[model samples]
Target: MNIFKRTGKMALGSRLRMLTAKFTDDASSIYNLYNIDMQPKWFPVFYVLSERDDVTITEIAVEIGHSQPSVSKIVREMAAKGLVIEKKDAADGRRNVVQLSAAGKAIIVKIQDQYQDVNDAVEELSAEANHDLWKAIEEWEFLLEQKSLFQRVRERRKQRESGFVEIVPYEAKYQSAFRELNVEWISTYFKMEEADYKSLDHADSYILDRGGHILVALYRGEPVGVCALIKMDDPDCDFELAKMAVSPKAQGQNIGWLLGNAAIEKARSLGAKSLYLESNTILKPAISLYHKLGFKKVTGRPTPYERANFQMELKLG
Candidate 1:
């Protein structure tokens, strides 16, 4: 039974493993034809050693994109087979370096024809298909580096969960909730300064009454997140996106993202041209979210809070 055929893309890792196993099996047979005693799995490390001399296992692992332990095991096996020599590193006594032995160098000369034949075969195989699997794999690796499959799936999940959340305008009943949420979040990461108290203690008088807006996220009819668009007097920006916080119990459901988007739209609806924010660099996830929301760092703006180390601004039409 072909489990991958039934599982489809969900079995991608398994399918790749199966294909690699087949390739490795064929490669071992090919090595036997050349009278070479080597495992197919050691080919990457062996080839790396053939090109370089006196390389550490960590260097080889990085070069071949394998783990240090895996590379170390292969180096030991090669040393056992008399194909490579291992010695303590002169610069670092704790580490060992490896290089091709005389036998290993001779094997490289003997396999020059085999390497050429393999390359030609790979080219021919790629040409036989309309879509080149080799090129596709390279492009896939590049894309995965930019945004992995895990992140892509997580985004989809966030999108699904965000639909269940409702962004509502500020209400009198949620006044304390807004204050508590922000206070809890801030106190968890930093001390609550006077500037924070001035806003949280009287959000309505300081924010809502002064041509600003506040957004609250409701999950199951309960407030789980909040963000404020405080009207700014700066010449460069119209509003400051401040006091964003999400409840720990309702975290990971994209509540912060939803509230942030809602707050931006609220500001834009109020004829805002740009938005600014103040935050510390220690809040990496929040900084990343701000970047994702199209915010860019800017200097020369003096901060009111001692904890704020960076300021970001988002230009809006």
Candidate 2:
């Protein structure tokens, strides 16, 4: 039984690695046949050097699609074998550049016939397989760069998990969840202050009964995210969009985003003119999310929370 064959696409990386091992072994034998003194892994660096002179590791990395550290390590290995030389860039005293040594140039000259033979062999192999592998690889890389595999999987995962998310108005049964969710996030980032406990402890009184609203997000009928449109006593803003929290497990599913937009619409329904929020600068993603929701930074207002160094307001018409 072949596990890779059975697993199919799930084993794509393993299958590619297996093929690489076979190809590398064949490359080693081919080098031996031509009396070459270089390893297959070092060929990329040597090929770049053969075409150019006085290049930095950054240039080599960009040319070959490899990382700077990997290129530097390969350069060091080649230097140890006396096949390459490293020199300080005359134009830039602080930086170093690499070029092929005399022996390296000799190796390229020796491999000219070998390169021709290898090219012919590859052409024949591609013809026999009826597949242009080089072109296919380029197309595959372009598509992956446009949208990474992680992003693709994340979208699919969200689609699958969203079936479990539900948004509902506040209920007495959800009091503990309302407090716990806020406490979990606040304790993780900053200290729990008097304002947090005041609203979280008795949300119905501190927020709801005072002409405010609360929205609860239920994942599989359990509270996973919650936010409040706390009515304000001030004249400028009608509501404070605060106490927004999402469970760690429910993150990446846009649960927080859904709740935020819901709260905004809910505030509008209640005839709100503007919305205000206070958050810490350390919560960069939260700040970014607020900005995306049309919230702009505001100043000159005193905050009640100890962690409120950043404030934003959104106008609702």
Candidate 3:
């Protein structure tokens, strides 16, 4: 019924639950269509167990981003189904380790093609949305471990209710703020490449003088986020969305979204035809934001940074 289209963010939890149920039911149907004899919910734990010879329940929980108790329950079901074997860890008798059984291995081997087909289908579905749901879900799970959903909600509510976030243009004194903000996100997900250092350390020489623009988000008059629209010398007068970050303290404040919208407007004001960005799939939130701003995936050219695997661009005019 397109619950997402109907409810939007007003009923996020309910919409997500409906979508999850739909996906799970569709996956089960696909397995049955392929003559596979496993439920869709078992794929995550089974896939993790298949990758390693032996792993503890806690380890599986960490790897699959599931709660220990939830993983243990799945393990018990799989063990009874003869799909997995659980044994006491030799080093820690209190800990129980698990592994895929011979039967499970045989079944997986038989359904390998089906797995590929499912993944390919998922990719096609993701293309329709212009973003990968699997990647988004995984990254969200990673973030939930770092900060709970309730905590993020409280922080966002406080920020919105207080109206402390303000978007402003880059100033000379904000050079250090720019560098620090960019470094925080890069160091968290990737190392700062030489290109990053060159541009960030000298914004005037590498960006401003080259007809680029930078925007900073201030929280209570302190620079808390930054994003840049870097001008390119190509015939199209392109702008690369680059060096964007928000301070951890100012996260959940919609600063990134504010900075991104500002950059897009700046690019248009500069007569840029399109905007490009390079990023890793692990940075799912960032990629999702780009998609939300009308960016679409494109084949990336050779990149100077090691972490860039996904490339996307937005048309301005």
Candidate 2 residues lying further than 4 Å off, grouped into runs, are 1-5, 88-95, 233-236, 268-273
lDDT of 2 by residue, 80-110 (tens): 9999999999999999999999999898889
Number of the predicted model whose lDDT against the real structure is largest: 2
Q: State the RMSD for candidate 1.
A: 4.2
Worst 10 residues of 1 by lDDT: 1-10
Quote the lDDT for 168 in model 1: 92
RMSD in order of candidates: 4.2, 2.8, 15.5
TM-scores, one per candidate: 0.75, 0.86, 0.52
TM-score, prediction 3: 0.52
Candidate 1 lDDT over residue span 129-198, tens digit each: 7898988999999999999999998888888888889999999999999999999989999999999999
Give candidate 1 regions above 4 Å deviation. Answer: 29-35, 51-59, 87-97, 109-131, 193-198, 219-222, 231-238, 249-254, 273-276, 291-317
Which is the leading candidate under TM-score? 2
lDDT of predicted model 2: 0.92
TM-score attained by model 2: 0.86
lDDT of each: 0.90, 0.92, 0.86
Q: Residue 149, candidate 2: how far off, in angstroms?
A: 2.1
